[model samples]
Target: MLLVKILKFNSALLTFLLFTSPIQANEFWGLESWMNSLKTPDFTKIKDVNQRKQAFFEYLLPEINKQNEKIVQLRHALKTDNINSFKLQKIYNRYRVKEGDIDTLLMRVDIIPASLILAQGAYESNWGRSRFAKYYHNFFGLWCFEKGCGIVPLKRDKAATHEVAKFSSLDKSVEYYMRSINRNSAYATLRKIRKNKRDKQAHITGLALAEGLENYAEIGYEYVETVQSIIRYNKLSQYDYKS
Candidate 1:
């Protein structure tokens, strides 16, 4: 009788594993498929400036929209339901918020506008023709501190220890970019601007938030102006309407 019980338990466990493993595999394959969708194109070969800009937008906008949709879902989850402590802690860690600081987590997990993402990507990667964008898939100029973690900047300061971060896919780069914008101290002003807009129930335009990005480049306000100029020039605000 004891032997028969043990055999039945083993059989049940085997059956459970057989049933669950394909679902796990399919989840992984689905993620792989999503990553595969964000293919990079050789923007440098496009001779016309207008054509290059259009191509760049077309390449990035879909991935950007997907990322924003994810954030919206996460934000909704946090607002509407009680998530498990482990999952809530993961959100806090991802946004660098203090544990139990639900308010800050909510603030930091919001979506960045697609227009702002496009403008920043266009400027930083030179419409995807930059060496870092081509080789490393690093569009937002993020840095990693560990050695061998990323590509060393050719023009890095002699004492600087940071290297530009590399990504396996453009969508991952966009994910990190949005997270950085949400959590990094340098972009606190931008967050505040976004929060205020949210409070007022106003349209969150890329042009409005660009005002807070004074520290994004060494030129301060000039950088903000340049980003706003790009948004205006390309009619990027049109994308922000749905953001």
Candidate 2:
């Protein structure tokens, strides 16, 4: 297992480096444009669910792999007690993680399946047409309680003061979304669910993962159901093959 993991980490590092290389790096508006430019069709106008899922998943798969690759690298780092790698250490520092906190690091570094991510993005961003999605490129409906950490909802309830998180680009939003779920205590159950699926080599179902995100919205259960509905209606289960 250790040898296999090391080989996988090496390959992943090479691929990650290639993807980030200036020649290969796409210089687009990022996560938003990455999806918006898929098939060069306006994302909002795609009325066919299957076709929509195709365009979206084709774009999302590479990103999910990239995140999981990072997790693999982190796992390798801990297993080998290698903490000084620049890229891995930077990612750890960005997540406010300590070098030796393996469990916390694992939870923070793992991947959320593309199926669940796509389903949540579709629901939260209104098929990429919401104001947060359009203006802020925030596809995840993430909120920031700090005044400057996010944008204030114009019609926000006076009693509620949380602001919707904003991102400079779509990729940043996606990165933060994964980090938020992986690191936040609220999503521990969700992480555990994904971890269990990995351990058992079982296919991850967006419906099951939705159980872990009950705290994602004020409406709670309604939000989970809505996400599950989107996943089922779009056949997103086809994309949850990550193992």
Model 2 segments more than 4 A misplaced: 1-42, 45-61, 85-99
Question: Candidate 2 on 1-243: residue-level lDDT in tens?
Answer: 985686576557555755786642233334433333332335666888768657666755666667757767776776687776776677677666786576667666666777788899887876766777766767788998987767798999889879998775656677888888877888888989977886788876777888898999989888888888888888877776455
Clashes (candidate 2): 0
Tell how far residue 193 is off in model 2, in angstroms: 1.6
**Cα TM-score per model:** 0.82, 0.72
- Look at candidate 2 and tell me the lDDT of residue 195: 78
Q: What's the C-alpha lDDT at position 26 in model 1?
A: 46
| lDDT (CA) per prediction | 0.82, 0.72
Best by lDDT: 1
What would the per-residue lDDT of candidate 1 be over residues 1-243, giving only the tens digit for each residue?
Answer: 985686576557646765777657545434443344334678989999999999999988999889989888888889986588789888888899999887888889887888888898999888988878876788887789999778898989999999998776787889988988899999999989889998999888889888888878889999998898999999998887464
Best by TM-score: 1
